[model samples]
Target: MHELAIADSIVQIADRHANGRRVTKVQLKVGHLRQVVPSALAFSFELVAQGTSVEGAELEMEEVPVTGSCRGCGVESRLKEFPLQCRACGSDDLRVLEGEELFVESLEMEEV
Candidate 1:
């Protein structure tokens, strides 16, 4: 699964930021549109972190919902389906504001 690669990348980033310190936790934000399985990511993190500073570190994920703004109605709403249409004006002209993000929010490190 691609989660393995994602997890590996996270570990690398954490390692760089940790500066040789032990990592205690890694907090991440995952958007709904990314369709990443949190459980799979956590599992992959454990596997990829073996023998590293990130090993046994807590992996916390915050899920973000898809949201969009309608140009016709000038209204912002949560999106539930594809073909992104405005809920208020039923206009196909919409701009996606969020829900395609995958990034590390913060990291906790132990003192050396």
Candidate 2:
């Protein structure tokens, strides 16, 4: 699953930034389009991070919804998927304003 690779990347980054410190938590911002299962990701993180600096660290995910704005009708709508369209005018002249994001927001650490 993509979540496995994503979790590995997160653990690597956390390991680097941890600098020998024990990681307590990692906060990630995941968009709706990612379709990442938080529980599964957490499980993967535990597997990938085992014996690493971030072992036993908590995975905290913040879900970000996809939002689109229509240039034709100046309307905004939340997109459940891709190919955003204006709800008001049924126009395809829509611009994505949010979503499609995957980033680590912050990390909590404790002294080793």
Ten-residue stretch with the least lDDT total in model 2: 78-87
Q: Which ranges in model 1 have alpha carbons more than 4 Å from their true place? A: 80-83
Q: How far is candidate 2 from the true structure (C-alpha RMSD, Å)?
A: 1.8
**Residue-wise C-alpha lDDT for candidate 1, range 1-112, written one tens digit per residue:** 8889889999999988988889999999988788888889999999989889888999999988889898888999898667678889889888889998889999999977
Please write out the lDDT profile of model 2 over residues 1-112, one tens digit for every residue: 8989999999999999999999999999998878899888989999999999999998999999988889998999997866667889989887878888998999999965
lDDT value, residue 36 of candidate 1 = 83
- TM-score top scorer: 1
Best by lDDT: 2
